[model samples]
Target: MTTQTQTAVIDQLSKHRTVRFFKDEPVSDDVVHTILNAARQSPTSSNRQTYSIMVVRNPETKKKLAVLAGNQKHVETCPVFFAFCADLSRLDVACEMHGEKHVKGLESTLVSTVDAALVGMSVNTAVESLGMGAVMIGGMRNHPKQVAELLGFPNGVYVVFGMCIGWPEWDKVPNVKPRLDESVIIHHEQYNTSSPVPQIEAYNQTMADYYGKERNLHESAWSGPLANQLKSPRRENLRSELESLGFVFK
Candidate 1:
């Protein structure tokens, strides 16, 4: 690619932000097709492509999903919503077609989940490149059973997450949030976990300032909320839920 093209790509990536507010407009079918095509090009585990994307456009369905997804308004308001599923059902059929027995367990679940995540990120990047905006809604997992039933998902299929896509309300678009310093996350060859406290402190202050100024919320540090979250079990029923959906993460 030319330097200009590379720079354009970098600029587009750097400007990514979660857009909660959207314009009262619909995305063109051509654009949707292009975005999904990009997602299809993403790499998958063992070339199995163990994932599925469901596009939801009906208002009533969106409303119901919004409620299920912790009442996120973007789920209801976005012109398009995608439910990305980690699906093993297709793999089962493929194995049967080839006269091979399908054996699914922890490894299979991990592969499918990774495949779904990779495609989801690819779709997000594609949306951003097209000057559209999106937000991933992990809250969809909060009530996986209900979400699955609502979408008529069969056993061996489950929603990994949802994405809301639309033309962002430019005036209300948020700035790109800060991430942890690379030093804290990236290690040189050997693993280095000597101490990340300082890095965490710095990042927390940076995030606190950003939230206070940009989001009009007061927070002393990011670690506090994260620590609080770790103090208790979250989604304790996820294991049973996954088992019910034909996943044996053993």
Candidate 2:
């Protein structure tokens, strides 16, 4: 019962993957404008649009950003890089203009973060539809303070993540990775976790097989590495860093 529009959208989404290697070609300003315009159409919390996208094209800036993002070469090589930021500074100005006291707290932080994520994902989808590829750089959070300083982010603004976009190397394109089974992820009208372990175990086997064939890696299960990763705190200084950026999570 799928319509043409639904099928087309689903096909595009199904083929998505993190494209790291790209060709050394420039993306035109017209394409960039179209992609960003698509991103701007994403929904925002309370219609506040508490987000900003920093398009980085300068070679030196991209080089420094690559270093800040754990020396990811793609950041430096991509024709277009974008820093998606959660921004409350504009909201503060709006409140001032309306003669209302600005509220800065955990709720505001969450809202802005969600807004930025929506825009970022929308941009990703738009780019992919246009036959371009992109990869998100969560490593931007490794040194949030430095990234903020380099980007000249003001108080009440912080980077959610970075994205590198360009034409992907066709030979280096990766397989469409498998995901968790719908039975475990989707619940009908309620939260159901009954017998989730078996579902996870099955998915682990599927992923392990995929990795063995695609990556030539030996792994018992996908969950093992992921579980180990959660044993330690990631970005231990992130809270203090966020506080310094004027996000009081009170």
Candidate 3:
């Protein structure tokens, strides 16, 4: 790709936003597989690469699963949807074949999580590069067991998140949402907070202005909304849900 192409790609990435609704067009199996192929090429922990993606094409299943993910309706309407799992089951099988009960301990759970996240991001980036759009459904964590049952996931595997993918829908196409300034989010050798204060303040104002115009909403600062989200606790039983779905966060 030329410099102009690269610049356009980056600009598209910068403009990318989570699409909540999608058109009725279907994504072909070839395209879905290609997207997953990109995910398979993502970097993983020590190249252990413990992750699996379950593409959900069944409408009934998607509908039921949508309720689990905060009742997000896009799960059903999106052309293609996928559930990325942090899979240790294959390692468990490998260990069993080696006559070991658990060669990879619970500590390795982190690696699988990292692998899954990496692959998910890889698929997202690839999709964006292709001019498609997607939104990651982290709310899948809110119903681990339900999701596992819906997907018929095996033991030693847990869904890290779900993703909705499709061509951009008209009304759902989004404007660029600003991000934090570099100084606020990036840190050098030692984590520096003092220097980020001004940058954060500036970013908050900038994003506030953007939201006010685009959303026709008030110019509220970032911290307030973030704090509000943090203050509203997640489902108290989420840990138990993970445990039931075979992830013992020990």
Candidate 4:
């Protein structure tokens, strides 16, 4: 971690934060194309590249997408929005051209989803490195069917997530969120089975300190909120909806 050894990419990554507020500045098409080209170089499963990016710049379209993404203002406010989709539509076409049928199953679903995620992360890094800010919108899944309809997605494609990129409102940008202790998360040669309760307890305090009095989430920090969230199944309709859209989990 010494300055001499630290790379620019590592430095940028270390300072990463989810930016929710943005300034009224548009991201140029040139910049978007550059970032996307770089991101497209990300490794894919068997070079299938089973993902598509939907770039949205239309104000009205962004407005509808914002509503679909649980009314997140940044989705509408950001200069550019990108929907990273797990797409098998292209694959189906490719197969048809070769006189073969495209098959779908659990593995295909996971591969396409992972491919989208990888490319999205690359795009985020590229954007941040270019002095812009971005936030990934998991809320894209809150109403997947509605989102697909709004965006005109094909049956063999679904958004894995969405991203909002724009110039940051520096005053509103939050501090980098702390992650779990390396000991708790990163295992050794073999999986470390020792209790992580101690590390998690320590992280809860770290998160509490990070949240501070403004947030007032002192006693119940990281784990508490997540526990509450996981108490019941979230996104109950996700499976059926994805299935209806032609994704096969099993």
Which candidate's lDDT is highest? 4
| Candidate 3 lDDT, 57-122, residue by residue in tens | 888888987899888988878878899999988877877898988655466778888899989988
Cα deviation in Å at residue 119, candidate 2?
Answer: 0.6
- Higher-ranked by TM-score: 2 or 3: 2
After superposition of all CA atoms, the RMSD between model 4 and the true structure is 1.9
Which stretches of model 1 miss by more than 4 angstroms? 1-6
lDDT of 1 by residue, 135-250 (tens): 99998888888888999988899899999999999889868988899997899999897899999999988988898988877675789998998999988878898889888888
lDDT of 3 at 185: 75
Evaluated at residue 135, the lDDT of candidate 2 is: 98
lDDT of 1: 0.90
Position 227, candidate 3: lDDT: 79
| 77-131 per-residue lDDT for model 4 (tens digits) | 9999999999999999999999999999999999999999999999999999998
Q: What would the TM-scores of all predictions be?
A: 0.94, 0.96, 0.90, 0.96
Cα deviation in Å at residue 229, candidate 1?
2.1
Cα lDDT, model 1, residue 63: 99
Query: lDDT rank, highest first?
Result: 4, 2, 1, 3
The window of 10 residues in a row where model 4 has the poorest summed lDDT is 211-220
